[model samples]
Each structure stands twice: as structure tokens, then as C-alpha cells.
Target: MARYFKYKSTADVMADAQSLGHELALADDLSPLFRPVTIGGRKAGNRLLVQPMEGCDGTLDGRPDELTFRRYQRFGGGGAKVIWGEATAICDEVRANTRQLLMAEHTLTGLEQMRRVTRAAHRAECGDDGDLLVGLQLTHSGRYSVRKPLLAMHDPLLDPLIVDKSTGRRVDASYSLLSDDDLKRIEDQFVVAARRAAHLGYDFIDLKQCHRYLLSELLAAKNRPGEYGGCLENRTRLIRNVIGRIRSEVPGLLIATRMNCYDGIPYRGVGEGENFIGQPCPHELPLVAAFGTNPHDHREEDLTEPLQVARDLRDWGVSLINVTLGNPYGNPHVIRPAEFPPIDGYYPPEHPLLGVLRHFRVARQIQAAVPEIPIVGSGYSWLQDFAPQAAAANIAAGHVALAGFGRATLSHPDFARTLQTEGRLNRKQVCRTFSYCTGLMRAKDHPLGQFPTGCPPFDKEVYGPIWKEVEQRT
Candidate 1:
């Protein structure tokens, strides 16, 4: 059991971070969280942003379904200034899930309607919509690509772990890696998507280069040959090129990037059969390859390259840079600070607070290095009721411009509103980091096709029956 399960107050959480050799402060007041701020040339109503947490519930033709509309409606009305939309695929085949939204000619009108719903919800809840900035994340799930996995460059770290979750068996197959010509086509598709996003009235578009996706994987492509591989410049060519075209063609929409500033190497089990699990101290040795880390010592980060990437993005005219770490597919604990592991996830190798500290410190480092650029920080969902205090402290300290939440919002979408009006969180409504959302999604898609994802066990009324059936079977 986690030590935090017994912690009862905000001070206890802060003390735990300090006892672990990491410092996290509690807010004296909630003013910092409610203060208005500006990013990418537009002013925001407050400093909180709803991080892109995808709900795999879109229609077959890539349009937002009722579930999708409800999720963003809560985000818009919940008082977060920036509603950072979830990852929507540029093309249908490259989607991460069967129901992942896609940006296309047929989906434009529906996408527009989704945005209108958000705006109306915001106006109704907050009395104004001028300060809310909504954006869409465009991505191609590289190794975890939907229907068929499309990898940029294969490596031993991630390839061997690919499994057919339905049977809990490792898949053995030689998958085709995407070529440079294929990358060029993908880049063009992104440019086209940006054009449509602009027309649909999205304030910005997050050219997502994170989470070991296609563009992010290219950043670690040291082995592949040709113009789109090798050096950092070549690796970033696709995103930079896409940005240039979007500026030339669309011009009106702003650009932002949700980038993975650091990647802790992949870890695998070192034991036998069904008992196999992640090595307890896997970071003892360096990683094979990673971004923003010493190639020789993957456990040690060398932010020189990642900092330069931030500078380049700013130079290319990006408004805000949202920072995250690790690949959730291979390294869930790093990206999300969870108490219990999901159905297919590994037991957390260390205390979950370590993951939270790593992200906080990384965001501080980036903010200090590029003081001119604005940054949105992740990993606050694990903070529970104390999230507002911790987020306020960081924002007040200038470590991060906005404190973002993912799973926390899925369970408690009214958190921001409650915090704004009541000045504290409703403890009963806060996420406990049970990771049931992830477990529910996996259960729904193990063999593919099921209910839309929300907080199944916590939200209860709508998802409780499905959770019960899943619990009975497993």
C-alpha cells in the first residue's frame, strides 16, 4: 500500500514531497490559480488548463459523438482558461484507437459544432467566452498506431514488448517501418488538418510531438537514414516544415506544442513466465536512446538539446509549450502518478511522488531557461485535493505558467468551478488515482469495441454496470 493512502491534509502531501528530497509548497491563497494570463498573443481567463485526455468515443467517420461533446462541454464550463483538446488524428488509419477523432473534410462541420457547444457552455457558466482558448492536438500514434502500427524507426526497447492484449500474449511479427516518402505525405496531411482547424474556429493547434508518437519518435531516430533522420534538425524537420506551411496557408490560427521534454528509457521484466515484472531498479544503467538525456546515461538528462528545441519552437512562432514526460504505452507510471497499476500496467517501480517531482523540476528548468516562453505543466492529478495549492505555488513561483490536469478532470470536471467559488476542493469528488479510467478503457478495447470512457468506478451511475461486468469477468 502507498504511504499517501493515510495522508489526510494538504500539508501532509507537501511534507511527503519534502521528506522524499523534493520540495512542493502549499498555497497561502487561491488567487494565483484564478489570475488571468496571456499566451500566444491571446489573454486567458485563468492559469488552469484542461490537459488533452482522449475519450475514445468518436463516430466511425471521425466526428465528435455525444460523449465527446459532453467531455469538452464540462471543460469549457469548468473555469479552465485553456481547454487543450485531446489528440485527433490527421488521417483515419493512423488513429490511436478506432474511435479517435480525425480532422477531415467530412468532419469539419461536426467539429465546428463541437467548438460552438464548448463556447456556449463557457458563456453560460462563466458569463463570458473571450478569455477561453481552445485548441486541438494533431498526432499519428507511431508504434501504437490504430488498426496497424506504423513505426518511424524500430528499436529493441519498445518493439519486443508489443502484445495482443486480448490473450495477454506477446505478438511476433515483422512490421513495416514507415519510409521518408511516407513521412512527407504525413506532414502534408498535418498541414491540411491545420488549415481545416483554422476554418473551424479553433484558437490554436497543438502539433503534438510527445508520448513516443510518430513525430516524437523521429526525435530519437539516430539510426534511420535520409533527410528526415539522424541529427536534431532532421528529426524536427517534419514539425517545423508543417508549421511553416500552416503559417503560409492558414495564418490566422496560433500554434503550440505538447512536447515530451524528457524520456526515461523503457524497462522490461527480468524474470520467468507469468511471474515476470519490471526490474525494481531499472534506471541503474543508462538507456539505449532517449530525448533530452545523456545518450551514455539515459537516467541523466542533458537538457541542452531539449532547451534548444524549445528555443526553436519559440523562434518558429509557437505561443505556448506544454511539457510532459515518458511514453504511457511503455512507461505509464512516468507519465501518470498512479497509486495502483492499470490492468496491463507495471507496478510502479518507485514512489509515485518521484514521477510528480521529476515533471515539476523539469518544467521549472525549462521555464528558467526560456523565460520568454510560456509553459503548461503536467502531473498534478496525483495531488488530489491539494492540487490547487501545489499548482498555485508553482504558478506563483514562476515555475510554470499554467497547471494542467488530466485524469483529475475526467472524474471531477467541476473542480475548477468549485475551487473558484468555494475556495477549496470537494474531497469526495477528487480523483483517488485508482487508475480505473485506464483499466476501463483497456477492458473496453481488449478485444476492441465497447462503451465510451469516463471514470467508470467513480462516476458510477453511467459506468458502474460496465465496471461490474468487467470486474466479474476479470
Candidate 2:
């Protein structure tokens, strides 16, 4: 029942969506996706934005090495107007992976060179990049931090899921939570990082607050007692203050956020049939501990706070808000609808279509409420060849300002180009959603492994043998 991608027709996709109690619509003409958009006085040539997906292959000093530069060049030449640069660490201590890119004074030169090549590639392939809006995502991995699982708030749902790399077992350790003073320093760090990005000529900076990151975790800090916790104003003070600083300091630089409107807990229960078809057991945990969740009944979603947050961000003069859901660390299927799970992932609790629908439905709600702010809608990669159809429909209907792709970009960097020129995606180049890229990443965290990430099958020269080796070990 979960293998919805096996059906090869749009009719089958629609029928499956109906079976899952949702509606999936598509546009006949995808011109809306190629339309230009303006944000914070900056213009993007097209509505196709690349999602900020980390390669975990940067230099040890956190600079964009050869692999990183090549990936961005492909993305630029591929015709996506907005190249949402992958998450770069604001501070070295909070780096997600050993090789995660870092935005710092020392590494600025490498980053600048990388951007030059990317824009050069864009001009060489797409003719011009005058309207191109390239942004850098500033992030602190928070509880998911590899260097130190830094915490602003203790999450009931996610705490148990943290496995110690040494033991490979779930054991809670007293990793220090950031004090209010520490939070202030981190806020300063973000501002400093933004200044660097502006100097590097990044069109925008995405203050990433999604997928259970530090900022997102702080939003769920209802239990913590401090000036930066308890109430909504207190909880969001960090991001608000950080943005306020950037706005005051960096005059015309665009600001955006990849925010999670909903954060869901991982499902745990007995498998259904021989094929594990039915839904997993309901998550019985109380949801008040998490942001954008019902306090009265934890299982249900309450978007009141999330919407208010959006409105507040709009008031803060944010240009774009990339709408996504769930923590990839804990609930990846919610954010990415994969037919096959990652190496250390779970069977999808629902149809991939339902997963895709959740993103658009939530995005539509936010778009209607915050009409002033343009939004980049996620979860379309699961649509495969039909992604452009669905994305264009949403864009034309005024549901979202742009259609974002991540995993699909890894396999087919030329997807947006093909979609624009041929009016359809090359079926062979479309991501089959093998999730081998994610598998390679997960493999890195297992005991002793360091595998470079990319679409193993598509990028066979390097990651192909690594994928085979890792597959055999697993």
C-alpha cells in the first residue's frame, strides 16, 4: 500500500490520493513555475528554488571544497532561479557533520570562489543570472549536533531517540543546554555570520528554524524557565532579535526562513502485515512539549502558534518562508515522502501522496494567512516526473510562490532546465527516490564510517562503490 510510486500515471496518483482521503491536483501548463518573483527588493528569475541540502563533503576547515563547488555549479547551470545554499554552520561547535560547511571570516574566500563558479555556470548555461537570488542558510544543529548535542530545551519526544555514537544505544547524557547568556552569544554569532554572507554578496540569508534544529527546538522551550522561554514572545525572542540585528546592520540583504509549521514525533509500534501495510501505532505522547502542536491533546496539530509566528515574521520584514514539516532526524518521511526508507529509517506510516498533500495543505494555509510573504513549498520531489505539474498548479493557484526540490536535485540537477525547455521531466533522470544518498549520510553516523554523499547511482564514479560497500555491510 505504501508503494504508490509504482503506478506510472497521473490518474493513478490522483486515485491513490483519493484512496488516502486527500486531493492531489496538477496544472497542464507549467509556465507559472518559470515566472519571476521579487522578495525584499531582490528578484528571482524563476519560481523553481533548490532546497538547502547538505553534501557532508566540505573541507575540514568548513570551506566549500571541490565537491561542494561542483554541486552548486550544477545547481546554478540547472536553471533554478533561487539556489538556496545548503546549511552552513554559524559556529564550529554546533556543526552537524564533520565536513559540514561553515560560514566564517577565514573560510569566506573559498565560499566566494564557489559562488563565482556557480554564477558563472548559470550565465554560461541559462544566459543570464541578473534576477538570480542565491541565499545561504545559517543553522545550528541543536540537539542533533554531532560535535555536542547542544540543547535550548529538552524535548520529551526526541530525547529518547538520541543514540550515543559510541554505544549505538539510546542513553541520555548531561550534554549542556545553552544558558540565556549562551543564547545571546549564539544570536550574536548569527548576526556576525549574516554580515559575512552579505559581504560575500549572498542575495539572502535563511535563518533555518526547521527539522528540530536549535532555533526550532527553542520554540518548543515551554518548560524551560528563562527570559528566553515559557511564553511565545520569550521563546521566539532569539530569532526575532537575530533578525532585528541583521535588518539593522545589513541594510538591503534579503532574509528568509525554512520553518517547520508542524513538528511530529517518530512512530513506534508493531509492524502490520507480511508487507507491513497498515499504519504504525499511534504516537501516544502529549504534544504540548513540541511547538505547533495541541496542548489539550498532544496527538493533534494546532497551527495557531505557527500561524502567529508567520505573521510575526512577516512583520519583521522576512521576504520568504520555506514551509516544511517534521524533524528529518526523527520523522524524515513527514518531510520527504520516500517509497524506500533510509538506512536507519522506518516504514512510511501513510501513503507518500498523503505526505506530499500535508506539505501543500499546510503551505496553502500559511500562504492564505500571510499573503504578504512569498513561500517556497516543499515535498514535491516525491511526485517524481509529475513534480512540475503539481508545483505549477500550486504556484498558479497562488498557494505558494515557488516549488522547492532537494533529493531530486541530487540525482537530476538539470531537472528544472529540462522541465522548462521540454515542458516535461526526463523520466529516466527523475529521482526514483532510492534514498541511497540519505543512506550514505546515515552510514557516516554508524560507529565508524565516513561516506561522501550524493546520488550513488547517478553519481556512480565516487559514491557508487561506497554505496555498494555500505549496502553489503548493512
Candidate 3:
């Protein structure tokens, strides 16, 4: 493999990571990191993953968009190995955000669009490495949403975004309690979506078991207070049931998850003292959304209990795990600084709830203890940093491997090629645009002009009128 001198004597690799455009690869060694892997026979190229972001880019009524297609297609254009689709609502009634990707096909046209996404990946122009593989993230938002009313693991307070069908005014937090039958119906819908995805030809499925989605909330004590709560077994039942069904039903799909508890083991928490956000290690917390305010003081291997549970789940047959730390609904200010993007409303720093750091050890510990399952380390990171030093840090800490930059990969798809070879990364400029983009993105499909949204272009069109509206109204 071709070699480049390591960033020596405080040489700023981060700067070199910028200015990436023409060249695609940095060195041959970084090639393996970008090549496809034969997973259960199907190829998931490169270790890079396009981390899912909720976008109303899809029609609110549940249809795919050309924008959605092109968005991911660009990531494919950038050449990530596994591309995660925008979170698609399993049930139209249970959407986490109004702008979520809806899998429910209200019409033949809807199915056609989804099919296009699948077909594009297989097209040769996407890359010589073979089209990037696609994976769908199915979510059932339980409580932690700013969206409309919906069903959940437990009844949720009316999400602030709920539009009162009767009065057309905002409603208070209302929990549309779900029953056993309703739960069954929703579960069936998820199955139907998975079946539909398999039918449409997605390579893998990510059961949105992390964050505060229905699966995680159900697994979290928030949803199942009594018999189904407290114990890890009770919490995991929701995910296991989903996995079991998908494995049994979807003949062509592979299943994976982002989780807090591996099995039934309630391991120790990661303290703020040991790990915090931004700083890479030791100071890093847990996986994003996995860190709780109360941290566990246990050493990596101390959790023999959960190790067995992880063993059971793997035995149950989950192939990979995306690790982040923090309770889905607990707190947002923990991981990175609160006003992370430091602008209006953009990608806030990975929430403390996102547990952006727990993977430092939990990932490797799981690898050491379970050792069989593929552990994906995530929480918004730099992939080019995976240069031997970062890779070794990951192994020493316990992450089986790296899940390269989410936005960076989005911006610079050829990150691996550029960083390793040219000693730089050809990145998309808007990445640091952060909250400017994230806030709007987080808002999903709602009309713009709500915030003094950034973007130099906005100065020309909407910002003036928006302020005029505000001034006149006020």
C-alpha cells in the first residue's frame, strides 16, 4: 500500500482536510477503509456511513422527493459504503417529525420514487466500486418529538407541533395512548414497511432503536413503566421482537441497531469527569443519546451481565451496532456546548442524550466481551482521522472500527482518498454551516422564515420579507 508521512510535529491534518476537490484518494492504505466489505454476501462498501438526519425533504403526505433522491445520490456520488436513508415513519400516524420519510405508500407513484433510489445505487455511473448500498432507518417516535400527535410506546404528551384538527390551533402535549391491539397494528406496519423495503431492494434495515424513537422509548423505561420497564430484558423486548420478525420475514435484508443496553445488562454510566464532548478520548462521554445525567463508574469489562445479554442478542442475530450515549429525551446540553452550531437553530452539538462518546470503551468492550458483532463507533466524527493513530485509539478504547464523518462524508464523499493520499480532505464547504442548516433541517418540511435563518443567499430573498412580516405583526 502507498504510504504518506503521518501528520508530524503538530502538522494540522484538519487544515489539509479542507481544500479537497479534484483528487479522490489519499493513499492506497486508506483504500481498504473505503472498499466494500462482503457482509453476509452483500457488499457494504467502505467503513463510511451517512448518518441519518430527519428531513421533511420527503412530502409531508409521505412521498419521496427528487431532492431526497439526489441528496443521497450525491452521498453515493461521494461514494460512502453504506448510505442510511432519511428516517421513514413506520406508521403515518406515528411520525417523529412532520417532514419524516414515510414508507407507507399512499399510491403507486410513491413506490416508484423509492424504487428510483434503489435503482440509482445500482447504476454504474455512481462509481466503479459498485453503487453504494442503501439501508432504511424505520422510526416510531414515542415522546421526544416536536411533531404532531401520534401513537407511542406509552401515551405521549401532545407534541408541541400538533395542529388541532378541530380548531387549527396548537395543542398541549397530548399522549395518544397506544393499546395492545394498536401496538400490534403498528408492529405489523413496521413489518410491512420492511417487507416493502425488501421488495423495493434495500440491502439492510436499521431498526431505529436509539434516540427517543418508539423502539428506544419502549426499550427505555419511559414507555413500559411496570412489567416491561426497569429490567433490561423488558426494555429490549421491543427491539428483539422487531429483529426477530425482520429476520424471520425479510429474506433478503440484514438487521442492525443503535442501542444503549446491549442485552439485559444495565452497565455503569459514563461520568462527565472521565469523558466529555469534543475532546476525543478519556474526556469523551458515551455514544450520542446514550449518556444519562448519572454516569456509571464501572470499568469496561465489569459488565459481565450485559456482555451475556449482548451475546444473547448477537445469538439472536444482530449484525452491527451504532453506539452513542445519553437518554434519548434526557438532556441536550451534555455532549457538546448547547449552542453548538453557535448560530440560530442548526445541528446542535451531538446532544448529551446522543451519548456522543460512550463508544470509546463500550464499543470495544462489546467487541472484547461479545467479540462477534460488528461495533460501529459514531457521534459525529472525522473519518480521515482514522489514520493509524485514530484507528489505534479506537481499538484501544474498544470500538471495532470507525464510522466516518456524517456531514463531512456528505460534503466530501472522497474524504478517504484525499486525506490519506494528498494529506488533505476535499470537503463540502457548508458543513461548518451547522445550526444554519441543522435548524432548518431539524424543522423538517415546515416553511422557512421562522428563524433569522443564515445563508448569504437568504439576505437577498426571504430574510427582508420575513423581518418585515415580524415587524408588521408585532
The lDDT per prediction is: 0.82, 0.83, 0.49
Question: After aligning candidate 1 to the native by TM-score, how far in Å is the CA of 470 from where it should be?
Answer: 2.9
Q: Distance (Å) between predicted and true CA of 100, model 1? A: 0.7
Best by lDDT: 2
lDDT value for candidate 1?
0.82
The true-versus-predicted C-alpha distance at residue 253 of model 1, in Å, is: 0.6
State the lDDT at 156 in candidate 2. Answer: 62
Over the stretch 1-474, how does candidate 1's per-residue lDDT look in tens digits? 334445778788878888898787878688999988888779999998999988877887789998899888888888888998898999988888777889988989888988898889999999999999999999888877656667777655776667534445554435567888999999999999988888899999999999998888888877667888788899889889998888888887899999988876775554554344455234433454578877677656678878888889888888899999988877788889887776667667778888888899888888887788789999998878888888999999999999999999988887888899899877877888888888766765334454467887567886677678778877
**Candidate 2: global Cα-lDDT?**
0.83
By TM-score, the best candidate is 2
In candidate 1, the residue pairs with backbone N, CA or C atoms under 3 Å apart (3 or more residues apart, or in different chains) clash, namely: none
- Tens-digit lDDT track of model 3 for 379-427: 4442334333343345344355445354444345445445546644443
Q: Which pairs of residues collide in candidate 2?
A: 287-298
Clash counts for the predictions, in order:
0, 1, 54
